[model samples]
Target chain A: MKLQHYIGGIEGLEPSSFEKKVFVQPWEERIFGIHVAMMGLSSHLEAVKSVPTKFNSFWTWGHLRQGAEGMNPFDYFKYRYYEKWLGGISGFFVESGYVTEEELSTKTEAYLVNLEAPLPSGGEPAIDAQIIEYLRVGDTPACDVEAQPKFKVGDTVTVRNPPPVDHCKLPGYLRTKKGVVDQVYEGTYNYYFPTGDGVGDPMPIYNVVFDSHDIWENITEPNTKIYVQIFEGYLEDPE
Target chain B: MTENVDRETYSAARVRALESLLIEKGIITGETVDKVIDFFEKDMGPFNGARIVAKAWVDPEFKERLLADTPSAIAELSFPRGMAGAEGENMAAVANTPEVHNLIVCTMCSCYPWPVLGLPPYWFKDPTFRARAIREPRKVLKEFGLDIDESKEVKVWDTSAQIRWFVLPERPDGTEGWTEEQLAAIVTPESMQGAAKVAVPA
Candidate 1:
């Protein structure tokens, strides 16, 4: 399927194609609210595990996408974005052994037991608002590891159209496209996989300027430029 | 909005079930959820962005520092600790000038400057906004009720994990000699996202 570009006034693309409404159903708001809660919960869980020191949305997103894949195609498309998060968290809990398939199937028993128990103290919870806020704001993955930038500002490069990998920051639309490095951030940046088993090596990040004509086949205004953040691994010396 | 409705099949039910299970397991408590919600609702949000923008408008040196080094400049002001986390890390500020108007979008995913702008709006995360913002920013801006001049160039910045971006909207003409508080009153979350211009009070 051709991914819809946010570009305005392109030929053959209608404004109606945009799903402009913020939310179509009331359930969507509930899903969003719960998703925010889950984010805090998941980060706390990840911290308690202490294997991965950082919170990675890509990790959660991978699981979320995988869970959606299990659903019927129609349901997958029909469900709102946060609904996918809700389902994905369910699947993740099971997969990570936080809960069991039988437990999920028999939700009532677990629900009743928890409801009956006296509420725990705020201090007892594995993660609190302060930690959540810290996780939200601290420890950017940019590292001080010594590394030379492969490309410099103004260098012409092409996005490496490598075969699809399990997880990536590189957008599919920009693959094999040419752009100029508008700005170069001089530091090795580490991007951890959501799975937390491994991380992409620290590398310089660049702001690459791709002309509108290059991004879209049809050019309305050639002067328009799109600035995208790209990692060194995603760029190749254009042949 | 009906408070009591049958919603067993809704995702919220599933979330409740999950929350209960976590509580039962002694992993988290009801307070944990409340704290997270309260932080976003009360402490951290676009209000912070408004304050920063107001400061920049009144203080020229701070504005230069904000545009040059956003995080450090932000630290100069007393916001609650934790400005350098996942959402706020590597933040860069783009100024909206008469010559240029900036629009921020994340085509890959919803990567936003949460410390200043708080969470992204629902439409900001939509696939349509991500895909079209780069291609047709002018039209998208117009849809948001912002009509940029035809002569001015619109620069669309696609934010990501590496760098988060927020816009410093131009101060309205009538706000001269106004206190920072008065200037801040006019800043809106949409203006920080470059979706709408800062409202000029009558």
Candidate 2:
């Protein structure tokens, strides 16, 4: 059976009426804060080539998502977003050789042994405030190459239905679906794959307009339109 | 409840382990982590978005520029110099009008305008919101307490790392003479996300 596009389907699940909140628990806040810190460190490590693992931003993100994918459905749904991040980063650290599996497992055991012990503190800072500021302000340069866009605005093109194993920008739901190109972003941008070998080829991005009815079966609102950004390589002439 | 506590403990311990390893490896230090957290908490957030929306509401020219070129117009204001960097690059602003309601989502992942809107709320990143927002946006908006007219069109922008999107919600009425500060006060992060409407003070 095709996966239901709407999360709870039409009749079975009731929409949540509970008050929407930013963070449900204190640990969530820590997760969010630490995720930021991890991202900053990852970027710094990538910059300095300090770690043996030479992954880019997208690779790190893909590894994080893959980690969540490994979890059981119950735990996956129950764990907060930052928890998923923690899991992903832990798995990534192990896979990248930055931290050993024994280290991760043993450290948790040590912490559990003395739960009341004061948290580890006091270390020479690697990224100073100025470095953090510079990193925060840094921008990735758009790919500068001369290339003709295969599809123009209003061209009907379908997303290639390739099962990409590594990091990719194309979403699963959009695969093999046809949409009209709404806007063409001329410049090619460098996107890294999960394989830390090197930066992948750059490609221009486009905004494709897909009708809600075309994408989903039970169309509640036919007038609704979903605009998704598609990379040039992902598009193909519709069969 | 025990399971929840165990998971949190495990997660926290993992972070601690990772931090220690990075520090030991000379990759990063605890102070670096604290500094990064401080930057997000103290330096950047939705306040910048509120300021931009308020400025647009008061200045017609700026509003036109914002809708036309978001990054340049945003740079016009006294926001940080890195407005075009990180999650802020290729930023696009879609205004909500009487005929069209704009909603932002990333069906693939949570791609939000971090520089302007700050960290996204948990629900914004939830799988339910990501899927249903495209399938049944009107129903989703209603859940957020926004009931749109049947005559209006709903446009959902599936944002990505390539182009980050934020909604320019229609300014609430009855605040014609209000200062930018007052207008900014009324704008919530949800309003900018188009999940909830901006309301006038009673």
Best model per DockQ: 2
Task: Please provide, for model 2 over A51-148, each residue's C-alpha lDDT reduced to its tens digit, 9 standing for 90 to 100.
Answer: 32222333334455546555565676675667777777667668878779988777767765554444455554434543464446644536777667
Write down the TM-score for model 2.
0.86
Angstrom error of the Cα, residue A218, model 2: value is 3.6
lDDT of 2 at B4: 50
Candidate 1, residue A235: how far the Cα is off, in Å: 0.3
Clash pairs detected, candidate 2: none
Cα RMSD of all models vs. native, in order, equals 5.2, 3.9
Give residue A182's error in model 2 in angstroms.
Answer: 1.3
- The alpha-carbon interface RMSD of model 2 comes to 4.1
- Model 2 over residues B1-202: C-alpha lDDT tens digits? 2245576576666566666666566555546566665666666678889999999999989999999899899988987666775577678898998899998887666778878887788778776677677778898888878998768889889875478899999998899999999999999888898899999978
Docking class of 1: acceptable
RMSD of 2: 3.9
Superposition TM-score, candidate 1 onto the true structure: 0.82
iRMS values in order, in angstroms? 5.6, 4.1
